[model samples]
Target: MLAALRGIAAPPDLPLIQRRNFLRVQIDAIGVGLASAAAPFLPIFLTRLGATSQEVSYLTSMPALTGLLLGIAIGQLLQKQRNIVRWFSAARFLVLLAYAVTALLIEVVPSAWLIRAILLLWALVTLPQTVVAVSFNVVMNGVAGPQHRYDLMSRRWSILGITMAITTAVAGQLLEHLPFPLNYQIVFSLLSLGSLISFAFSSKIELPPQPISNASRTNSVFTRLSHLLGQIWREKPFVRFVSIRFIFLIGTTLAAPLFPLYYVREVKASDAWIGIFNTAQTAVLLVGYFAWTMISRARGSRFTLLVTTFGVSLYPILVAHTHQVQVIALIAGVAGFFQAGIDLVFFDELMKTIPDGQSAIFVAVAQTLTHLSSFIAPIASAWLSDLYSLPIALTLSGIIRFLGFGLFLTLGRKDS
Candidate 1:
């Protein structure tokens, strides 16, 4: 209901806002627990249905591709929204239902047509997810208030990571023990229930009145974007941060296509091995979040981001070098440690740079750029893999990730 995003009134105090944040963390635990358990396996699912590496790239890239094309439009649209929570919940509910239905269909579809059906179904279901993703941020920012934001967000990430770490560990065992398709079917079906619970918890958070967006009337969105980019560039500290993020994102996208292939084809990892890899990373996220919290508090988000990126950059390199499943899991755990830093710090850095009175516009502009890179890199990565090899692609990704470290070196001392 639209009424949900536009609540009766702002909660009168900071305590109320923090209380809402606590509720979100609880709901997130469930939703993330289930979705994380299923999402990583999606590529694996396609492989089981006989999808080629190129086709797998399409599914992997679809969310970012969708964001690249629709992020600006939807983000701009959200700025005008009075009931963002309602809008987000509605979109999320549909995505969950789609997952549930697809899970059931997986049980009945013919083996030959299954992959195509899954691809088509995936596209249709995920269309609104970009809206959900951006709006959730917008709503959370509104709910958490400025004073409590860092602490709340840090705890939220830590809690969600803690949840995924546990659930993935269990899901992996279930997948390894259960028959093919059945394990997936049960987990995918659970996605809907978890999402529904999340939506319910999300609905309880009250929002402050929306600050009206000053989207220029005469200047087209693209023209305004050009100006926003210039403004951010002039804000040198923010520019340095975004630049590092841009490079880091490229590496992440580049590494995306190689993971499933490396584990399945190269290492011959079992289902439990896959789960342990994810669990290792997620378990480390708990450490990363809290440790980064202390580090960012003591040293600042920029310093924290730069230092942790070294660990982040090592993950693909680890994959490229190792064939042993257990080492891969350990590598994942190490990567998770850095991932928490990025997860906790990235938004803090972005929010720090946002011009007062321009949160929505700033977020939209950032998403557009980030999603564009994310969209292009996956397709390019697939092409690179097709021409050379997955190993080549993974090696290249490591090199790209390391480039972020180099860029961090150039950041002005004031940024730290």
Candidate 2:
């Protein structure tokens, strides 16, 4: 493995100031990998334990709702706290318990309703992990500085993708040997162990001190929005970028809930194949993210984001046409590559166009739009899928996403 890694071309050298933060970045990358490797397999595990389609749908959407509420609250709380690493670490540790519960109950509760209840409970438990992710974004931006932000974040994601791919492959092989409930329990136990690695490495990283504050708190959403809107209005690029974010996310969410279902039901994918598909997806993401990091460092985030969004617009069409399990898995993997390129640079690019004071607010707005879309889109996708066919639903999503891409292009133009 060491020799193979050494054969890989090296990343662009970071300046001395930025280089020291690499260890923290690695730890964050590892944590993200561990968490993500567990995600694609959860619905698979639930289904094996007897969860229905509707139950799976509920499980998927419930997390988004809970994440939205908890993420907002945590964003507010972080504004007051001085130290965030401990909180971030603790949240990750606790969130693993959600998986533990699933593992523990999969054998005992074979009923669909009982399993759905467990999923709902798991959503509530998993929320803090979502909030902790905000802390990561904040800290990483600080560590990398504005100039290196996109490259640093992209590299982190590359590392995450690689780790997840490798781990999932190993887990898949191990899981193939086990049967039913035992297989799921073993996976969760391993996932929890991975969480321990995150906890341990996190404790090693030193955090920058937060500036002391002596101000009273104001807790009104409308009041916060009033202040944020004025700030965003003053910044045209920020406004344009965030609008693009909102539109793209709306289209993405419109299709997300249906993707797994389509693969499982329409394409008739097995659990092992789904794991391989996920592994392939992450592998492509790892490659794409690193490549984009190198490209965007010189070409600018706006250009890279535009190109990548165009790539993602092609995903729905590819996915729609794919009938065979292998073909679907291939398209899914390639889709992740495109998504990675967009994900790495887009937000950091958006921040480049915003005032430092307004970064959190803008991030919050983008996240809120994403979450709101998540809540709304799934029901629509479900209805459309039920009424028409999965392919039609996917094709429709592709068209809308392309429209979003066009809207993004129109952002800086006044007379268009």
Candidate 3:
């Protein structure tokens, strides 16, 4: 792994600053990997804590609700800042802090109140999370510039994927071996340590000074917002892509809360099996990132997007039909491969649409749309699950995803 990282950082023509930034970004991904290892388990923890499907849905929707309200405002704020890296690092730290808080709360909060307390904690976390969401792309895009986005992100995600896979495997074993809440507490605490590493390295990333626009400062917030919206509206490609992506995202977010429910409630998967599921998915991402990067270079982002979207759209339906946990893990690996392509292509395509010097606001606009879908979809899926069944809800999600894929197939083109 070290050799691979060194090879990635070894482009002799790359500027010293960029080379250093690449290393920092890779290191930060390690921290991100460690922190994210906690992700698959959080909802599982909530389920074990006796949370309802609606409450579990809150895990996804609550964050989106905050992002829906605050994404644009935070984006505008980031655009005004001379340095967004600071905001990005700070927000990341605060978000990671919530995991530690969750760990602490496990000891003191009554079992009945624990779910509510955890929900409230994350609700407060959404403020900083919104900042992270808006500023992360700005900072990373600035660091990679237009030319190196694929190379930088591919390497970073590969590192992140491997780290997450390893740590997640370990986390699963910990959960299986230790007592209930204690095992989770330790996992959360251990994972939160990554935030310190993230903060330290991410703060060191150097980017060219932002070209701040003063025209908005003199205007009322509402007028400035209107101007920003008007700017986004005129970018036809941005509008079209964001609209299509929004539809695709509904399918994505709708399935978010249902997976753990399916794994735990429907399949009765053990903690060890859950860990294997995540590890299988994440471990394949290294190959997925490499393969997709090559495909994007050869076939273009449009082709990559269509293929990946269609492939990923099949995942929920596959899971819905399969009863075996091992088969689901295999399916997850295949889905992760396509998911990597979607991640890369989506970022590249969205960045392509933004006008120069307006990444923050544009990204915020995109994120806001994402949050709107996220806020609605998970709740709706939960309702479907409650009223009917998990398999039924998951099938609907796959259908929505296929519709999005069809739209991409028909309308997504360079000239369109």
Candidate 4:
């Protein structure tokens, strides 16, 4: 298994620089996986802490709010800078630091203020988060270049998936076996150490210096802003892709908070079961990434996109009908398979839409649109879940996803 994974990830005949960067990218994935192990549990922790749905929705909504405000500005700022990897590494460090802060807050903050404090901490980190979001694509695209993106990302994400699977399983066991609050505190603190690993290796990723933008340093901020808008307007493909993706993202994000809420409230799943849920999904991604990469290679990204988009649209609806955690884990596994395809196709398609030398700014525009949906969807879903039932809200999510899938069937076929 390990050898096969290596065979898939590490293709031969690369120059020395790309080879080294590829290895570094995979190692960085391990660190990322470790840190991301804490993600599924954050909302679970909030729920256990007696946080209301609106407060819980803040986890998704706050970052989106900040991203909407800061994403484009950060993108433009990065375009001006010569070394985006520096910005990428620094931003990643701060974003991961929030988990460590959350760990400390569990010990020191008053019970009444804990949720607010965590939410505020996350909100404040959105600045760096925006930087990371913008710079990440730039850095990764630089590392993979045009020819090796699928190879690099598939291996990178596969490693990340396996790492996340193991760590999340351990985290679930720790949460089940260890005492409350302290178990969480320990898990968060230890998991946060992955940030240091991420920072160290990510900082070492060597990209050729970006050519500085020549947009006239003398231009007023408004002038530059107008220029940026003009650039985006001219990229008709990017505009159309972002528009369709915005709708798809709404369906995905609307179901985000509802899953944990349903698992915790409706299903009454234990911590161990939640871990299994995440584990099942992530473990499948290891296979999914490789499988979808082959499918994309053979059938093209357009076909892959249609199939995967339609496949994933069924996840929430399937979960809505089931009450058993075991069955839900199976459903999550199915979702993970298609989700891997979506990630690969989306990244490839988005990068294809971006013109050379405009990765940061173009990706920023996309992220800003994504944040717009992320901001509205979760809160809306939470409201729907609150007003109706979890199943009803989840069914609505599937319905919306089907609509996005329909758009893909028509508009997605036009992509080259």
Top-scoring candidate (TM-score): 3
Encode model 3's per-residue lDDT on 271-379: one tens digit a residue. 9999999999999999999899999889888889889999999999999998899899999999999999888888878888899999999999999999999999999
The lDDT for every candidate, in the order shown, is 0.74, 0.69, 0.90, 0.90
Residues 1-416, candidate 4: write the lDDT tens digits: 75454444568777777777887788788888899899999999999999999989889998899889988888888988888899999888888878889999999999999989988888898889889888988899999989878888888999999999999999999999999989999999999888888888899999998877676367889998898889889988888888888999999999999999999999999999999999999999999999999999999988988999999999999999999999999999999999999988888889998999889889999999999999999999989998999999999999988998888888746673
Q: Which residue ranges in model 4 land beyond 4 Å of their true spot? A: 1-9, 412-416
Give the winner by lDDT: 1 or 4.
4
Look at candidate 4 and tell me the lDDT of residue 292. 93
The best-first sequence of candidates by TM-score reads 3, 4, 1, 2
Show the colliding residue pairs in model 1: none
Question: Would you list the rank order by lDDT, best first?
Answer: 3, 4, 1, 2
Lowest lDDT block of 10, candidate 4: 1-10
For lDDT, the strongest prediction is 3
Candidate 3 lDDT: 0.90
TM-score, structure 1 vs. true: 0.90
Candidate 1 Cα lDDT to native: 0.74
Q: Model 2, poorest ten-residue lDDT window?
A: 2-11
Query: Residue-wise lDDT of candidate 1 within 209-274, one digit each (tens)?
Result: 666655554678688678766866787666667767888789888888778877888888988899
